[model samples]
Target chain A: MTGDGQSQARPRFEFRRNTWILAAGFLALLCAVNYFLQDNFFEPGVMVSNLTTFTPLILIAIGQTYVILASDIDLSVGAIVSLVNVVTVSIMHHLGGDALAVAAGIGAGVATGLAAGAANGLCVAALRFQPIITTFATGTVFAGLALWILPDAGTVQAPEPVWRTYSASFVGVPFVIWSLGVVALGCWLYSRSRPYLTLMAVGGNIRAAFGSGLPVMRTRIAGYVICGLFCSLGALALTGETATGDPLIGIAFTLSSISAVVLGGTALSGGVGGVLGSVLGAILLGLISNVIFFAGTPFEYQNLIQGVIVLVALAGGVFVSRGGAR
Target chain B: MSAARERTRSGPRWYRHSLVLTLAIIVVLFAAGETLSPGFAAPGQVIYLLVTASLLGFVAAGQNLVILGGREGIDLSVGGMISLGALIAGNVMDASNAAILPALLATLAGTFALGAVNGLGVTFLRIPPLVMTLGMYGVIQGLLIVITRGVPSGRAAPMLSAFVNEPLVLGIPGILFAWAAFAAFVIWMLRSTAFGLRIYAIGANENAAALSGVAIRRTRVLLFALSGMCAGLTGFLVLGFSGNVFIGVGDQYMLPSIIAVVIGGTSLAGGIGGHHGTVAGAIVLVLLQSILTTLNIDPSGRAMIFGGTLLLLMFFYGRQQRLRV
Candidate 1:
């Protein structure tokens, strides 16, 4: 029935079909590499550790996929994450990390993320500012606000055992892994849903999508809201893992997240990839870094490898899209 | 067709000239400063403003070249190149071996090569400029960190600094002289060269440009390289200003570079603006910062103000562009 609908809806199962195959093949490659690089890569214990470490990045990539799929970009997600991290710590510190207070902190953090995302959306969709420049400016503002609120490092010691064990593993499976799995599953479901299909059409061809009366602006606003929510959740996961917050910690994640999204076969042009692709992308990146860690690669070489991966991935994406016609 | 074109051009006459408006804003800012503190109106402060704005001014010029190349072309790596360039120059011309010309040339070459790598990644490797530049930025930053071991590296040659520090004829800062010379070169290139025409055509519509026999790829590559050159020269200026090469020398220039270009009335939509507007935009940006500094606002507050101004200008200018189209 889905295949019949797919044919009726669009003749381009070729794109999706090929992309799925590519993603699976890439995942296999990554797993194999991870096996050889890390001694316990296949073990549940190491897998759990990798999942916990990869959670925040995966979360950020999930949000970024939406923004990029909308044909706009958000450079400020890292800064927004930093802001959330700092704010959550400060709020929790003041509220003594009570259960209610933790919820409030996360809520406030999500609110800030939405505000930043809304500002970017308005700038891009309304004011017509280039996403790169507008987001850059707002990123600075958010980061500045973060610094202002928490000028120095501090602790947000959760009083509740449940909260304290947020990052803990169960049966050798990290809680972060579970959380990421849930978020990833939600995103995958959304991507397959009608709303996300409409979003994809909008990004795929704005003029056509607009002519179809798809409520492009509303879709864009929703995309940003989703991005904001994911970023906030990523911030929470970051806080759980680190126990302490630094306003500057989110800086490095920005490049890594972008690299992951692009590497995972998502068309930078948008409307072409799913959250599973992004998760694979994040995992691929995480594994690459893990390889570097195991191989005793210097920090600079690791950075170089990341730069190479993004370039190669981008080149691959462009090549695939053009179908070598160029 | 010409008549229709003329009508199109004339329609954008009054409101499209935002450089004039930005100039007005600068004048008002300066006048407000004068009224508030007569000391600020002194020639010294004006000279200082010119000097301080030059770095961003030059970088903005480079950014305009890339932005105008149109196909989502921007050197996010420009800021990183500036830092990397400065660091290389610093390392090469260590405190004992402060050979000026060698240091300058070496830094220029190093930055140019870095910029070329970005160009290669985009043009040859077919990476999107945004992804390519973003990744390169990180790689460059990490490399710099490794090289410097997270500390400020290299001292500016005192003689070179002094020369750069020296005022030119009419008491203008020597940095202003360098800025003017570079701007003159860019403006001349824009007006008198085949490369400039190609850039304009490519930016206007890459498909049309390709159809018209413009070497789209070559033009893009050139623009990226030129952007690198601009960042390199700006690195030298940064060293002179700071007297030491720090990891963050390129940090503040990134936003200001883009803002300067846009404020100077260059369109972010590409193919519509020039280096002249970027120079004006740079002056406007510096003036805005100067006014904020005069107000004694905290850096964070100043950042907020700067962002607010950018959003307002972008909104206004973007509307104008849309209306024209």
Candidate 2:
């Protein structure tokens, strides 16, 4: 089994080698820039806050990595976040915000995310809808359902103990750090799993994978399911941060996650990237935003600069990878 | 036999006959509207629907060209182009109508230049059309924000407003005449010209067309430029209609334009549809909106319906082909 796995993964590892290196180097550079620009960037408190800010996007980008690696895309992840956030918050609110209610709400939110992912997966992998447009349409549907559930943004304070546990540290280590550790470990383990390789194989060449006796449809569907699960987790993280439910909160996640995935050196063409790069990519994006904010750029020009930088980063990543391949 | 072969070659049996489906849908939507609200079938209401549909139709015309140019061609920047065009034209036009022509020309030229950049990125740099146009959307949006400082200040030129709103013939708006002429021109360009033929050939199969001597790069560039110009023109029209320009004036049209093209039976896979169907599509969408509005559906419900409809349409049209383009 080890030999079989090694043989199957070798070609992909070769394709992905330089991207991981580039992503790591770029992430380090971004962190260094942020440290210099931010007066207290190295403080544990500041670092914890930054990590908290980075956590949701990191999770979403990881989920997105699976879909993109399978040569499919999910524009509806943001909508799933929106839906799950609303559903969780609403449930907690209706249940009077008790500890048990909060637990139940969290479970419901995860279920909503899984359900949305399953819908998208069925449409793309089974029903044969175009991935981009299908997801775009489904995103609208999810967003609408969210709006229906909560017609307006509302604040529902979870029981004090819930958020306290979230923000609080166990044994002088932050809960966020523990959460990140668990997430990272989970991703690492999954990366080495057979299903991950199957997804990569399916994405690299659907016909070839099919010929090689891979369950192409199931692999693609599983990618979406995994993505949905991560998006729900991101939604939960967002709930912890905001303690509020807004149907519109996750609108920015779709493009940002896609950008993070691309910036992480994952080819949009699929089959040649990993979750670790996406984690760094999400951090790099957050750090870039922070650096821009701290550098005293006018508020209006910030969006412009960010847009230009993302385009440049995208173009640069594409150029470097192409050159390396040649 | 040759004719039959050509028909089969062009598209699937249902697609070749999709115009009938579109017309039938439009008729049904109209009937639904009439049943829901007695005033809906009135001539004034019909004219209103046509005028609104004409705006989307113009944008769809350009979008059809880009989508038809193949290689997964799409332009997400249409909304940005429309906004930028309107902003430029609105700012340039003083109370005096004299500034209108120059403003219109400048808007066209500026937007075309931007579209050319998208074309270059897609064709030369090998950026996927999706990412390239999305990036262009961001750049245009950011530039507009910076230039306008989050507040747009300008009134529509008097002449433009008059042309757009005033009745030119038999209680029909003057804009209808302009729309009619533009539609005629687009139809001619797509069907009766060498450029049109090349667009079809390239959309059908890029490598095959290129090998057969089609100027793939130039045609693609022109296609995107044309999409930009159409968006620009819609911008000016929108300014005339609203008598003002704002940051997000073009936001609503982007998805609707794509929906219009797809409804008209133009394959997202490229090379298998035409502008006429898009025209019908725009009308159908407008009529659908009218019906939805009359039924008093909330905005959220409307969004769900719109998305659900798009999914159903795609499933119907796309399921025939198993291979993902």
Q: Best candidate, DockQ-wise?
A: 2
How does residue A312 of candidate 2 score in lDDT? 73
Against the true structure, what is each candidate's TM-score? 0.90, 0.93
**Model 2: per-residue Cα lDDT over A101-148, one tens digit each:** 999999999999999999999999989887887898899999999988
Q: Write the per-residue lDDT of candidate 1 for residues B240-276, one digit (tens) a residue.
A: 7777888878977876887787677666666666677
RMSD of 1: 4.6
Model 1 spans > 4 angstroms off:
A1-13, A16-27, A155-163, A169-173, A321-325, B1-16, B34-38, B95-98, B145-152, B319-325
Candidate 2 yields a Cα-based lDDT of 0.83
DockQ of each: 0.34, 0.38
For A1-326, candidate 1 gives per-residue lDDT tens digits of 11210122344547652443454566687688767877678887778778778888889988998988887778888988998888777776677777877778778888887887887777777665767777777777777777777766654443454346775667876677678668767876886799988888877776678888787777877777777788888888888878776877688777777777776666676666666667777877777777767878876567666556655665565544333323
Alpha-carbon deviation at A147 in model 2, angstroms = 0.8
